[model samples]
Target: MSRYGPRPFFPGLAAALLAASVTAAPAVVTDPTAVTVALAAPVAAGMAPNCATPPALARSVSAVPWPQQRYAPERLHPLATGAGVTVAVVDSGVDRRHPQLAGRVLGGTDLLDPGGDGTRDCVGHGTGVASIIAAVPHDGSGLRGLAPAARILPVRVSEQQVVDGQGTGRTVAPDDFARAIRWAVDNNADVVNLSVVLYADHTAVRDAVGYALARDVVVVAAVGNLHGNGDPRPYPAAYEGVLGVGAIGADGVRADFSQVGSYVDLVAPGSDVLMAAPGQGHHRAEGTSYATPFVAATAALLREYHPELSAEEVAGRLKSTADPAPGNGYGAGVLNPYRAITETTGGAVARSAPVIALADDRPDPALVAQQNRRADARQRAVLLATVGGVVVVGIVLVALVVPRGARRRWRPADPN
Candidate 1:
């Protein structure tokens, strides 16, 4: 009865139903690019004025006990505190006036609103992420970042919509997302932290990531929080060559809300993560978005210690040195900053790899084309295989059932 062919009642009907179910997976919903701010709970008010002197801020943070003992960056700080490394935070702007981030933030562009200040964090999400990566705790406050000495370059790509002290919606256009990444690479960012996620895979975004990798710029992204939906690969986290980071708790177990996927490359403490919030106070936040900066800051440390290592090599070192844990969601394992900083690689430098280029960076058109062709071919092959399988199964079922149906129709009624 179907347009494709006549329907069979026995085996053919079963085969058709099987094929339909096989292809009935839920349609992928492509949500707009947005900042991943999970839970922001104001724990305590550290100081009267948030913009205190470095010494005062340190004193305030030192009074807190959890952040210092949790990740324990002090063990590796003596070796390298991410000196001379520039980390670009591409998210909802950063609070340049935050006491912990004073004098560390560099000039960055605001792609969402041109001519606007990128350092002014209205949503507070970006500031939290930045503080966790490079906030100086030397003055004594408990709010110490992974790489205290590293410089932060704040690139604002998403506009945060805050309602009742919580970020309700943070959205960025695909083009703006791509532009912010390219801008970071062009500005010589040593490590770029993307604490936002786009549900759809935009080519412009992928190209920008490729461009960063080619220029030896380390790109780290959050693997996204599960928004009630099943795990979906988030971009630029899911993009090739990006270092995707998932969230773990203080107990070293994966956070329940952290999205699991093959693209996840590292895990860090995200639950009850104490960091600087806007208005000079400290907040305990949760999400993979918070976990990503830890990895980015660690990348900055590795870059500082091993300046000779390529971007890929820096990523490899992080993966190789991670504390081994089980699960595709956990990637190689939980981030081991101590081992990452101190471990020696037998004094061998990584081999030189081809660099991807931006528009102004002498891009190779032929190489880009070849890579695209390969990706296209692979996609086409998958499609062909799926369709071929359905057709083959249908034909076999028809062959088996046609003769049996004929026998049943031709059989004499007297036999009954």
Candidate 2:
């Protein structure tokens, strides 16, 4: 009945718990050269395969998701709606036919199949990710994207989450996964959202991430969902320039499944978060994958409003403007799109001042030290001058007062 033949369902694997609903979890792309990252849960028997059938269509939702409500797109859009920016979703294919995604998706590359555009979503992960970034509001539905005006460039690299069993759809090798990142960059993507996670680091993937960063592209990725299973270091999240993201629930605490590590650069709403389904509805999903888009969308907004800012500068702004971290494992803190968009670099409050040029938060230490030395010199000069003036005044007073006291015949001077 299924494409992968009737394989015994492995209930012990971590994927089995989330098998019913498709999540933004990373799909392991098997290759001889690439290191294989096993699922977070221990495999009792053989590795667990993808679902027997594609995910069912999610029911339409009218209630505004908690992330959306918390970010309050109404307030953010007035400032910047992520206009004139393109965010590449490097994950499973994105279903561009969704009502909310209409006119927002571009004809992107599909590494899996070269003939077709990257609009077909068999796994439904990319669509939800795209929705969080740029899906437009429609028909009074409360569900809308953080950057509705931004365009999505989908790069379909994997079709299913299966690691051992290759299903009907082909999964690209790790090299091709590297190629996908290059493709997204070549296509002029301003921001790239990587909901996919890999436990083991690979040279090809690491190099590709460096390529994107070299080109000034903002790279946002999930830290991985393996806190229980040793929380192996995940990449491209752990890559030097990549913005490693962790997930937090509505309660503003790190999700139990979200990996805790030094790589986590920021946290966003990930638990019980709502996302746009493939066909025509929404699904309640949670993962570092889901949380990745919120930061990606915020990056989109930042790029839209401040086009001159380099990718690293934009990332700095996002981190600097975030709310206070609840505790460890929560990177800069929860993703605050409003603050990310409205605040200046180094956490300075934005005002009605005319826009001049972008500020560099990381001033050169040498230059700073030099300025400090100059300031100290000026302060010392001013202090010396003041002391000299005080000494002169004291001498003048002594000269005048002594004479006045003698003239007063050793009596107290009278007030005149």
Candidate 3:
């Protein structure tokens, strides 16, 4: 297995990665060339051993033998899917044609028109991040995304680390990022995933992040992959409104290259994370870029169950409910979608919302008729399916509908 480390956001910070695990005590990667892996320990009340299977051959927990990847599935898979929440993936666009993602991508814009696509990925980083949240995977390949039912809005940007044919490393300006944030919020995206980082004290970036916060849109960012040097906070991740995510290797310790400190919010599986590449098939990549999506996807899942919690509150819950306590670089704790989505505390907060807030407003007969027509269609479908001894869980499988003209790169995730 070839492991290419993500480029550093700062100078002199080399990326040294191995799968870290918490199933046991912390283990460090001595050989950078070796493909290190830390298999998820059998779900129990103990630690994960450092001697588990490697990522090169590790199947998703869903494919592993009974109880291997199984946890409380009932509690983990919520009846309420991420139907209403939309996630804007401001990265290298997405494969709209992927089965798992087909029909799920909402409208998106291309920032790097010269070398980008709303559906193409050059380095495969954006696709990997998108899959972590929405990829249903080609069956039996053993890749299960954290939020398998969430919808994504693929926002394209250049590879900050990669150069073009002319050999130019593009700079992701603060204004570009701010525009993406507002676009996500304006377009009904409940969450925004920023998988890249910049180390600048730009006021424009702050205002953009603050804009999302004011709108109650949850924003999650990659903490950054570059340790050893003093941890200078990475952009958006270091920004106050965003939840900065870190990476945990197989030993369950923070990766040598993962940045840390107060800016960190949570951690996730960052080493050799498997997902759809920019085009097709599966590939593995390393860095906090991948970890941030897990947090973003988990937030969507949490919203499906806790709809009223503001994005900030959701971030708080994620940090509060994370597993294995955070460390020098891993923030509040490791990311655990299974726990955060189903974990419930305190009496449920209920807001009193009236069906109609205006008494003098007159109803539009045409609009009412359209709504009635859709309602009738749904009712008939339910009745026919039930009476004929058949039923469909179509609406339950997703919270959002896959409309036409989604990302042009759509691909069905279901191999079947």
Candidate 4:
């Protein structure tokens, strides 16, 4: 997905970011007594440095048993499984036969061809992306989505793709994408995930996205993956009221190529992150493209919990409570499922005391300097003490020689 990244400006949040890296971090609490914030900046330890084409999936690992996988949809399973919510995915296409996503999908439209074949996974990318939103762990193998009960409305725009010199792959046309968006809205999808990015200047695409928003459908679009200057003018993301998401890595750092700007709304795990693929396999992909589904999944969960919530409300909950990252550029930081499901995200209100965590994303130059200065002072004090002790010893040695005769006279007079 190649679009634009939102670099939201919040001077007040900087303090919270500073506080997050320090001692005894609390659960994303806004108000607490004396949370120790490390004045030092955070290191982008595990983040992908720049936008690179997301690599193909690693050789399939033995499928993880259903009970022991990280992507197991435990917290969300009991609530609703997004049973009543339908999410539309505008991308390559999905493989309904994939074990993890079996039987959960609802009907969808295909814009790539005249035939009705939205379930085909020509690129395997759509299957992977859709499964990540609603995959069921089959027979204790493969990955499950956060909201597996939710249904996928897969809309394909391309047969396959070839990644050009730029980070994005080319296959889908912009006109097809616009048509897909309208189809999603017409089909009553509560959330629409756009995982494809193509270059086109058309108002119809914006109108499609806006149409979904007016109907209270969440239009989640990836902020594209062009890392440096290859970024085109803002597309569906820049359109008002659409939720634009960026791609970050497992390190909780922003991907270098996921476009960054004032329009970006949030980010999630996108780099080397594993999800279901076509042909009974699993793999990792990069870019804001892959990350948008995670947000859509969260929206599905929210709609499941509170069917009364509008798209704006669901979006607010996601962004407000999202996990705070120091350098994460948006109103919300990283998209965290555990927090989002429980309504524990710190973005709920303007924090009074500031949330403190040990996982800050910036470097604290002042803190480093203080530590160095303290060490230097301690060394100087120790040196002075050692010198004073040595001088006292030398005086005692010299006095011992002179004092004997004088001491004898003074002592004898006293005795007499």
Q: What is residue 47's positional error in candidate 1, in angstroms?
A: 16
lDDT of 3 by residue, 268-323 (tens): 76766666644345555566777778788878887777765666678888887777
RMSD of each: 23.8, 13.1, 18.1, 22.6
Question: Candidate 3: lDDT of 297?
Answer: 80
Q: Put down candidate 1 lDDT per residue, 321-341, tens digits, no spaces.
A: 889776657988999887887
Global fold similarity of model 3 (TM-score)? 0.65
Weakest ten-residue segment in model 2 by summed lDDT: 1-10
Stretches of candidate 2 exceeding 4 Å from the true structure: 1-54, 161-169, 347-416
**Candidate with maximal TM-score:** 2
Clashes of 4: 25
Look at candidate 1 and tell me the lDDT of residue 37. 27
For model 3, state the Cα shift of residue 285 in Å. 1.2
Residue-level lDDT for 183 in candidate 1? 84
List, residue by residue over 1-416, the lDDT tens digit for candidate 4.
Answer: 22212211112221211110111121232422222111111111111112123334334435552222433467557765777788987765677866677887666766645676588654556676787798886654556787788889988665433332111222334545677887777777889987644323356576667667656687787775544544443456656676778777666688776767655788876665566656465655455666778888988988787654567777778887777776845447877665666764333222223212224356444334534655776788899999999999999988896688676664435554
- Which residue segments of model 1 deviate by more than 4 Å? 1-67, 138-140, 162-170, 326-328, 346-416
Give each model's whole-structure lDDT.
0.67, 0.70, 0.58, 0.59
- What lDDT tens digits, residue by residue, belong to model 2 across residues 66-92? 888788999999989889889999877
Per-residue error for 37 in candidate 2, Å, reads 8.1
